[model samples]
Target: MHEAKSQNISILSYLANRFDTPVMAHIAFVGINKSFLGHYVGAHEVMHDVMTKLNGTRRLGLPSRMIDRLILVFTVSCCWLAAWLDINVLSIVESFAGPAGAIILLLLPMYAVRRVPALAPYRGRISNVFVTVIGIFTVSAIFYGLLG
Candidate 1:
């Protein structure tokens, strides 16, 4: 039991570190409440809570949740601004890294989350949201590419 628990913690920590940049960059550039941002943020928070609980520490405060929601709102507003400026944020990422890269950008973190045993209970919800977000982004990107 102890060994399994430790392994889970290590995996979660690895995933959290790996996912940190992409999550931040996505929110910073592409905005949130769209794509997989909400799901990703939720997964991250859940992982954090799990880690804290495992360590026998307090769960994160409500303030953290509020901040996350606020960031989502801010990102959605920024998306509107980007549209006004004729900037296709997804396209920009695709331009630099290609379609596969964009898809991988979204999938990598999700794959990491799926690997954590601690998250097994929430796997169904996580995967459903993940697939939905990926589908939405894929269709939009393809349409945007074809039209643009």
Candidate 2:
């Protein structure tokens, strides 16, 4: 177990050196391990748990577990389709970066400060309001540019 963990760490470190950012490094490492389908599978697991909770008593006729499995199947199919279509993934990522950056760098921190009890002391600060406005503006600008 120790040797395996060390190997994983080395791989991640190598990816970190190769990629521009830690997020990119982690994404690269994950992709290297199992290709992009790894992300979809992880998403499926999380969504499965969430759907199971939201679908109490199997409201969809099928068992709740079956619904989760169907979601996984659909997602995997879409993943394969996207792969076969040779989609320009970099372009898709670039388009989303502006809005996603704003949300991650600005909005999420402000949200945490406002909602998290541990951050209650910093709540309602002017900085939070300013940051949130900027974040919203950034997102809006990105969307507007995309649409118009």
Cα lDDT tens digits for candidate 1, 1-148: 3442444323333444557755555444454335457766676577556555544555444455665565557657776797678664444664656555655666555665678887677566756586758856875787687678
Query: Largest lDDT belongs to which candidate?
Result: 2
After TM-score superposition, what is the CA distance of residue 53 in candidate 1 from its true location, in Å?
15
Cα deviation in Å at residue 5, candidate 1?
50
TM-score of model 1 (CA atoms):
0.26
Q: Write out the backbone clash pairs for model 1.
A: none
Question: Which residue pairs in candidate 2 have backbone atoms (N, alpha carbon, C) closer than 3 angstroms, thus clashing?
Answer: none
lDDT by residue (tens digit), candidate 2, 1-148: 3442444344455656655569867776766668556776788788887777777655655686687778978887987898788676555776898888888999999989978899999987788889999999999989998788
Worst 10-residue stretch by lDDT in candidate 2? 1-10
By summed lDDT, the worst window of 10 consecutive residues in model 1 runs over 4-13
> In model 2, which runs have C-alpha deviations exceeding 4 angstroms?
1-33, 57-68
